[model samples]
Structure formats: C-alpha cells, structure tokens
Target chain A: MKDTKRQTWMGLLARADAGRVPELLGQAGPSPDFEWLRAPEIGSVMVQGRTGGTGAPFNLGEMTVTRCTLRLSSGEVGHACLKGRRKGDAEAAAVVDALMQTPAETLMRSKVLGPLAEDAARARHCRAAKAAATKVDFFTMVRGED
Target chain B: MYVAVKGGERAIENAHAWLAEERRGDTDVAELDIQQIREQLSLAVNRVMAEGSLHDPDLAALAIKQARGDLIEAIFLIRAYRTTLPRFGTTKPVETAEMACDRRISATFKDVPGGQVLGPTFDYTHRLLDFKLAAEGEPVTAEQRDADPAPVPHVTEFLNRESLIEEAPRDDTPPPDLTREPLELPAARALRLQALSRADEGFTLSMAYSTQRGYARNHAFVGELRVGTVPVEMEIPELGFAVEIGEITLTECETVNQFKGSRTEPPQFTRGYGLVFGHSERKAISMALVDRALRWEELGEDNSGAPAQDAEFVLYHADNIQASGFLEHIKLPHYVDFQSELELVRKMRREANAQTREAAE
Candidate 1:
C-alpha cells in the first residue's frame, strides 16, 4: 500500500540531503523569530526498520518527520512539512500546511493556526504570572520579646 | 566559559548515603535479617512469588528488602531476574494427586476420599489477637497426625464415570505462556486461565465476586482446593524419561459450575480450573470463577456483557505491572500534548464569544 504520510516525510529528507531544502521550502534565512509560522505538515511518515534480509517481515520504526514554512498575506508566516515514505508528498504537504495558516481559509485558520498562537500566548502569560507571584523578598523576622 | 550547575554526582552520593542510614534505622534496634523476612514475612514472599512467577523465597525476600518492602517492586525485581534466567527445558505437568497435601478442602462433598485436611487455616479463629504473639513468644510443641499414603483422586473423575460433568479433554500440546507472548483477542481456555493464574489477586477476586453477584453467574461450587508441594519433573532427552528436578508448592482450585443442556449435547456439569504458585487460595478460587465466567460463549450461554465476560478487557488490564505502568506513566511529561489541546480550546472559546457578541449586536 502507498502510505502518503511516509512518502511526504521521505521527500523532505531527500530535499534536506540535496542541500536545497531552504530554497525549495522558500525560506530567505534561518529565522527562529517567526512565532506565527506554522510547522511543516508531512503526510504519514513511513518508519523503516533495518532490512535484515530480503523476504523478511518488514519492521516499521517511526514516521519520518518533515516540515515547511510559508508567509501569509498579512505577514503572518506559516509552514508545514508532510511526513511520508516518499519525497514529492512532503513538499506538497508543507505548502498546504503553510497555506492553511492564511486568514482566507476559515476551517484551516480556526482548526489549526488560531489555536496554536492562542495556546503559545496563554503559556507565556501563565509562566510570567507564576514568576511574578513567586518573587521572594529577603526579610528577617523581628525577634519576639518575653 | 559560562557554567550552569555542578555537584550532581556528589549530591547523588550524599543522597544515597542518607538513604542507607535511613534503611538501617535506630542503632539500638536489631536489624531484620533476610532469613526472618523469608520465613516470618513468608506471605509477602508468597505474593511476590505468585506475581513474579518465581519460587525462590530468599531471593524474593532480598528483593523486598531492596525495594523497601514494596511487594510489587519485589515481584518486578524477581520477574526481571526470571526473564534473564536461561530455560534449559520445560517441566512435565505436575501430578496433584501425588501432592503431599498441606491443606485440601472440598465444598462439593461432605467427606472426600482422602478426607478434608484443614492444615494451618484461620477459618474458625476468633477476631481476638493473641497477646502472647504480640511479645516475643516461646516455641510451642506441635502434635503430628499419622500419615496416610493413600492417593486422593479428583471428585470430578468420579462424576465423569456417571457422565454427569463434561469430560475435559487432555491434550499433550504445549500451552501458550502469557508472560512470553502478547495476549490476543478470543483467547483459548489455556491462555485465559494462564493469564488469570498469575493475575493480581484483588482484581481477580473482585471480577469473580461480580460474577457471583448475578453477572455471568455460573453457580460455582469449589470442587476442591488443594495447596501442597508437588515434584517438578523435566524430561531428559538422552535418557528418554522424565526426571524429578525439584519441588514447588502450588494452590489448585477446581470449580464445578451449573450446566445447561443443549439440543444436540447431553446435560452435564461444567468445570473451571485455577492453578497458581504458592499458598494463594484466594487467587486460585477467584481465577477459577473468572475462568468459568469467560467460558459462557463456548457453553452457549447468553452474552451478559459483564467485565468478566469481556476477554480483551480482562486479559489486557489484569496485570498490575502493565496497569500501574500505564496508569502511573501519566505523571511523566505530557506538556506537548496538553499544549496542543490547550490551544484548541482557547481558540474555540474565543470564536464562540465573538459569535455571541455579533448576535447581540
């Protein structure tokens, strides 16, 4: 059976190997500052095991991971990498993942990107609040007189 | 270069030293020897043996000490050791009829052939705790009964002569080991019974109890409950005969349950069997009941959809090791999955609020 996810992830791995992943993925430079950017969407990544020999029970290890980046019209960057057993599938999945982050797509925007950003914000706020509350003042207690 | 933290190794060493000191406890008090735990704390050792599928009391006691008296942890230690031990050969089926009985009871008969020997049971004991045992007591002389060399045949074998109970077919085929293999759906009687035998006693008891409470009620009578030491024999390939290797104490419970007559088949009472390591009558009895309950489908009984009736559910969740491992693993890091869910709910609520404002406007 043709596993689409495995195919997609393998494709990204191939791209990475070719040293043209950034160009094909359309990334100008390595930018970790892009908070709104969605991770690459890979289809089901095929996890292959060590081929002991021919005609042996094929062991699938883990899904190959792939991802992509995209810049939305509102300058909101998004990316997705498709993971699969094959190559071409990964590139397509990543573009689709990035496109889904656009405001124009309601289902994609609501289901995927909006929630991710909101979660990130909530986590940051919660951490900041906790840090503020735990701010300890080094003060010595007054000794009580008999 | 900027340094973050240090002294992890030193801190670990200090913590271990403190733990050792804590284990030792008060200097004045005598330390609990391994032998004392092996003999005096034998019930704990038995539990570890049954669960671990190992029989070494000394090793089990040592494991219990190392685990700080956690019986399950000791069982795990024993199981780890058991897995590493080489399997030289498989043992022949133990002959329980040849068992040197410690305790044998039959609920089916008013008096069985070999007679009911109530050896070391707390059945008729009053709730009052003996004050003598509270303090270090003296060793009392025990009276011995005249030994009977006569063998005790199974009650079901006699019933088989009259064609009253269903004849259990004896097969020489090797049974599946639950510990060695992953459990599959629609398990055979051998596999199901094997799983229940080593299953958690409390869990098995509750499941069996549920059956008695009208859920897949088999109307089971304890045909016989035998606890004794039986000789373990392994076949010598070159000699072409089985040789007695060692002896192991076993608790075997056979339940005679109510039978329904089918159109094609004769009306005969069904049997449920349970066998476990050590003097674990509770586990053995519970295992028998659950085993009988699981056989409803084969016996042409209606599906009750009870927890006991669900083979997949019972077999999968029965092991304390698997149950506790999966149950306690939730305590480990789950921030990644939680973060995903968190984001989804926040956006969903936000969207709902936005829609409500729009409607009000």
Candidate 2:
C-alpha cells in the first residue's frame, strides 16, 4: 500500500472509539514493545472559520482534543490526535500507528484498520440514509408561455 | 480635591452576599434548578445560546441561573466559557438547505413543497395574561402528529429556476472569523453576516426595523423561515474523509429583496441570509434584513447613510457584551479623571473673568 493509505488507516484507528480499540488490538495478537515518546495529553485548539463561508478568516471557537506521540522499539514513530478527552484512545491509536509502519503492517491493516474503516463507513451510511429519507424533490408546473 | 477612595472590599463582599440572597429570593419558595430553567424558560435559553454562539443548553441554563435570570449576563458567561474551550476543527459550513425542519414557513408561497408547519409559535396567540399561571396550573398536553419525513426544499430555488433572482455564486473560500481576529472594514458580506448572527438581538432587531421604516428599504419578502437541526461534519485528513461529529438546532431565514439593477445590469431579486444557533426566528429574520441593508455597496446601490447600511457602525456596536462593558464601566471609580476635569473647568472660568475685568477697566 502507498504511504498515504497507511497514514489514512492509522488516522481511522486513532479516531475509533477508545473502547473498541482494545478489541481490535486483541484480534491483531501480541503487542510489540514501544516506549512513550510523549504520553497522551488533552489540550484545545482554536477553531477558525471564514465569514459566510468565503469571507475573511475569524476565530469561531475552541473544542477539546486529545493528542499523543510514541515510538516503537523497532524505530517507527507514530502520532495521534483525536476529538474529545480520550487519553487511552489517543495512546492506543499512537501504538497502532507505530505498528502500521513496522513488519506487522499487513497484520494491523487486516485486523485493526480494515474493521475500523468498515465500521466508520457503515455509521456514515446509516446517517446518510436517515437524512436521505427526508429528501424532498421539488418540481414546478408548466405555466403559460412567457 | 477628590482623594482616592479605599476599603471597598468589605462593601463588595456584603453586596455579593445580599445579591446571592436576592437571587434565591423568598425562603419559602424553592430555588430554581438549572434543568428547570433549561426546560421551562427555553426561549430565554435559546436567546442566550444564539447570542453566546454556544450550542450547549445545559451550560446556557447554568449561566442563566448564575446571572440571576439576566439574559445578556448569561450570554456573557457563555461567551467567556467558550473562549477557554479547545477547538477540534471547523466543520464544513452547515447546509441549511438540508435542514430537517420542525417549523417551516414562507410568506411568498402558500403551498410550499413541505406544507407550512407552524410547530410551536406565539405568532397567532393573543396578548393576554394567563392569570392561571399565577397559581399552580394544570399540565397542558400538546397535540401530536407524525413528523413529516421529507426535506423541505428552499423557496428561493423556485425563483432561481426562472432566473428571477441574482445568481449567488458558489465559492468555497474560508471566511474570516471575528472572534479570533480584529474586525477590519469594508467588511465582506460573510463577515457582516457573522457579526449580525451573534449580534445583540435587540440591537439587530432595531437595525432591521430601521430598514422597514424607509431607511434603505429593500421591499423584503420572507422567502423562507426554517427552524431545524443539521448535522455537523468535520474532515479528518488522516482518514481522507469527513465524519459526522454531532447535530445542532439552527434557525435560518432567507429574504428576497427588490433590487433595482444599475445601468450595467437588469433588475433582479437580491438575497439576505440569516442563520443562528438555536430556535431564534425573530433574530434570524432581523439578521437577514440587516444583512441585505449592509450589502448596498456590492449591489451597486447608492449609500443611503442608514445605520443598518453602515457596516462598521453596525458590527462594532451590535455586540451586547462589548456595549454593556463600556456602558457599565462608568460605575467604577473615576475620581482622578473627574478631579482633572474640575480643575480644567475652574481654570477656564478664571481666565474668562480676568479678560472681562480688563475690558471693563
């Protein structure tokens, strides 16, 4: 797989629910040794937006986010930033991220990333279907010639 | 001759204690719970959320309670609390066109695609005092119906089909945020709308009302007014896709205004847009009117010198928090400044008297 695809899977794994990460990790078998380059820490980022949608950039507001960085014993570095205050989620994500770069890349992809990607896609489809149910197709009747 | 006043700490403490007592008035009556405030005084909570630019109803209710039922103060608390939060990321601009509307109405069309649903409104209610509420009142059951499971199409699309309205160009450029950056002028339409959306409701209402009172009147028709919930989605660069974060209730109003096109163009209908955080239709409609009034320059219309039409004046003064801060700061001690003013006045009067005496001599 391309490096970009690997990075995408790492991101999906990180954002997956903290509780779900362990189950996916268990399915992938024994974990590789890794040292915490940086433990997961919660912080905020200032969110900015353009006026209307195309105007000058302005600070809209801030939201809570958790981020972490780790390095595996095999010399692969990984990082994760997830929405909300989930420290374990960030840590687990960073570990998965590191594993994706090592020899276990294919194993992690099938047992972890693949399932995560599928779950996310399914959730999105469900929401889209719900919203689509409300879709109203409007039509205009033919009036007399102008 | 004013000396610096001191020993205000005790006074302030006593005043706070008294205020707290007042806030929980009448020992016989129970103190108002935050949940009660959130559910019962929902309109006030909506106003706070809209002006505060925060969607958390629980926080808004808490702010309201802390501020002793002062709506503006509650909004102030929400704004202050909002600044401390960490931002995840900005969602793609919410598509109000796809709103799952609970209340939808259009003045321009009687029979719209999704028929007009009044929902809960005070529009038709007579302005009569419900004295029964003065005592313990019976629970009023609401009439229920299965919600219409269809997206209500925008009323403007009809006009667009005939090319009656000016084409709103599709642009995906990010707009400026007023909260993080200082507002610069000759502001664009997007920036002005952002200011109006979070602008003080009373101030925005008056500015919009001014337009209707013949100040840069645009002959506005309420093309559509909708209150509904829209899902917020954010793009994750790692996933190479966007995900739904949550949903928020929003009030959107679009007004079609008569525009007399200039020599270079033909007459066409212009659009005024308003979108607010919660069920705040009045504020949203007011915002739309003010938004249209502010677009005079781009529309090739002559500057009418109206308060609503002046972008800088409207944007700067419309924030209640800023307005109230400056207005209330006068209550603070100003002895030094007042003393200096007194000296200057005395000095000027003495000089004038000496000149008069010299002239008489």
Candidate 3:
C-alpha cells in the first residue's frame, strides 16, 4: 500500500525506541480520554524472506510485536503495531495516531511524531557514517609481476 | 507394562535451588545485566537470534544470563517462549534490494556500484588479547564519513544480464512453514533454505567446510555478502494498507558456484544463497556453501554420495534442539529398559556355564 500520513506516523511510532513514546506523549499535553477498542496485546509475526534474497519467498522466522486499537472520545479509531512487548509504547502510539486525525493533529504531530522522526533519522545517519568510513577504495599499485 | 514412578519431588526441587544459586555466582561481584550481555556480548545475542529463530535481543540476553552463558540452553528457552506467542500472520517478504546496508562486499568484482563497505568487522583485527580490557576498557568511537545513499544491487545480476549465470526463477508459491509442517525429504529449495537459516552453526559450518575440502566441491566464490538493516512491514487488515512494524538486522551471503555443462543445460555459474537474522557473516556464508552442495541432484550433477549432498541426512541432523533432546534424554531415568538388557545378558551367561559343565563331565 501507498505511504499515507497515517502510515508514516505509524511506522515512526513503531520503530521508536522502547518506552520512549509514552514518556514523549506524556509531555505532549493533556491526555485525551480514549477507550480501548483492543487492549495492548503481545504477539508474533512470522517474518518472511525471498529465496536468494530476490526470488521465491520463504518464511525466515518470527519476531515479537505488540499491537493495540483505541477509539478517542471524539470517535476516531486508531491502531498500532510495534516491535517488541512494550505495552506502554503501544498505548501511547495508538493514542497519538487517533489524535493525529482530530483537531489536535497539529499539536501532536509537532510535539510527538516530529521529535521521534528526527531521532530515527539521526540514528540512521550515524550508522551510515560509521559504515561509510569502512568503504574500501582499491588503487592499482606498481608490482614486479605486473 | 508401564508404572508411575514418583517420590523425587524434594530432590528435584533442591537441585533447581542449587542451580539458581550457581547461576548467581559470587554475589560480591557486580551482577551481569541483560543490557551488558545484549551490547558487549552482541555476537552471542546474534547467534541466539539466528538459531533460536527469534529476533528479540533483550530476551536472548536474558536467556543467556539464565542459562549461564550456555548458548544452546539459551536457544532452548527462546524456542519455548515462541511456542506461546499467538502468530499475527506473516509479513510481506522483506526486500533486500531496499536494505540500508552498513556493510556490503563482493569478491567477484574489484569494485562494485555501492563500493565495498567493510562495516564493523573483525577480519583485520589481530588475535592478540587486549589485557587492558580485563580492567575497564575506554569508550571507543568509529571513524565517520559521508555515506552514499544508494541501493547496492546484487552482484549476480550483472552475470544474469549477460546470460553467464543461471537465472533464479520467480515463484509466487507461499513457502511451507518449518515449524508447522512435518519435515519431508526431497524438500523444496525454500524449505531447505529455511531449515539451513536456523540450523546449528557448528554443524552447518562443518558441512560447508566439507565442500571446500573437495567433498562435492563446486569451486564456490563469495559473490556478495551484505550486513544491514531492513524495514519489516506488515499489511494490516483493518487499515487496508501495510505499516512498518519494525526493522531487523540481516546477514546475507550469495555464493557463485562453478557449474559445468549438464546434459540438459549449458555451462554457467550457479548460485547458493543464505539469509539470517542479525549480523552473522560466518553463519550466512556457511549456509550459502551448504545450500550449493545440496543442489547437486537438482542441478543435474552427480550426487557424489557426500554427506552435505544428502538432503535427508543434512536436514535431519541440522536442528540442535532435536539432536540435543534425543541425546540429553538418555541421562534420564530408564530402569526398565536397562533392567531388561541386564536380564538377557545374565540368562545367556547361565546357559553357557551349564553347557560347559556338561561337556567337562
């Protein structure tokens, strides 16, 4: 499916550092009352891979993922599927996801998702930089055999 | 002929109590934290993730600590934990081409499009131990440079373009689940690869080494090896779209093996592939070689009667869990089985003695 606004925020929230989302969401302002459509539940998703990394698909294994669904008092439903068994993170993510559709969308986006995305980007860049330093640059040298 | 045996509950409980005490050896010393094991002993965590077939670093670390650094025991814990988790369907197959590679190398070419990024590797490190590390090692930082953000194409694709390497056919068939389905022989490549990915590292390594030593040798070269992180996306039924659940570190190895002309096909380069969770370069490479060795029959080459070429033997013995279970169970109480053997031996001895006495008389 195409990357929508909900998709972007959901991905960011899922990939956020463990337990970091709730702490951030706590400071994002007053907690809007929301009902648990589906309580925070832990499960596993069977991760699949392609044969030869490009051909036929195969099941590699499974990883832990926690997901939850919530509905705001204003009636917008939100869902979250994140890695690992961080119940608090899932609850916070689902709340933020629902709030993103409400009038407080701008407030939540700026306060919560914005910082999370920045942190993820910085981490990515740091890893890439370290890897880039290791890139091998081969040069032809004068050899007696040559 | 079966009877219930009891009355060892107290002894069993005492033994476990003793085991727990040993697990926390020397209370004076600082207790090893899960984060320490997860970070400092990252390789162990990687091995557990690969063989345990689960991708939780924290859980693997906790298992290692609980098992007292015994990796196989830790894997057993992880395997048991996975059985309890409700599976929330399979994700869309990860795209390696879109992986954000930290390390990528190709042996077939001097320089590839993405360049050979060595990443964090111990290949060039000296074997000498750093004695200072025994005390407290200083924090170290890796050198940094601007990274080129581009997809590193698979090296074999270059050969495929020119018809020099056999093509890997695209199949839409959903692969058989290794955990759910009973393992049957003459397995498909997908199933074989799945088993190999989670196979015992030592067993897979030895099998791969056999090929190097001319047991069904195929003149293999590392076409490409990449270690990187890729986003794992799952399609949500409620949303009618896929959402990125998380990312996992992967080690992928592609071995280009030399294939002579068969009766049906022309001479061309064949491929052996491996993909595993976490950064396990050695295991990935070993898996690739063994994968190639197992393809002899499918590739129309002579079977050569090698152990690595025998799919049944390789697949059956590859799992450490099954092998460990059967081997470890022998130590358990088996009085009936042992007593029956003893009685048979004694009866034969008595009969032999009577016959000897009669002859002498």
* lDDT-superior candidate, 2 or 3: 3
Interface RMSD of each: 27.3, 6.8, 1.3
What would the per-residue lDDT of candidate 3 be over residues B146-209, giving only the tens digit for each residue? 9766677888888899898888777778999889999898799899999999999999999999
Of the candidates shown, which would achieve the greatest DockQ relative to the real structure? 3
- Clashes found in each candidate (C-alpha, N, C closer than 3 A): 40, 19, 0
List the DockQ of the predictions in order: 0.01, 0.12, 0.76
The true-versus-predicted C-alpha distance at residue B57 of model 2, in Å, is 1.3
- The lDDT of each candidate is 0.62, 0.75, 0.91
Q: Can you tell me which runs of candidate 1 are displaced by over 4 Å?
A: A1-146, B1-23
Tell me, by TM-score, which candidate is best. Answer: 3
Best by lDDT: 3
In terms of docking quality, model 1 is incorrect
Query: 1 or 3: which has the higher lDDT?
Result: 3
TM-scores, all models, native as reference = 0.66, 0.75, 0.97
Which regions of candidate 2 are displaced past 4 Å?
A1-146, B1-6, B359-361
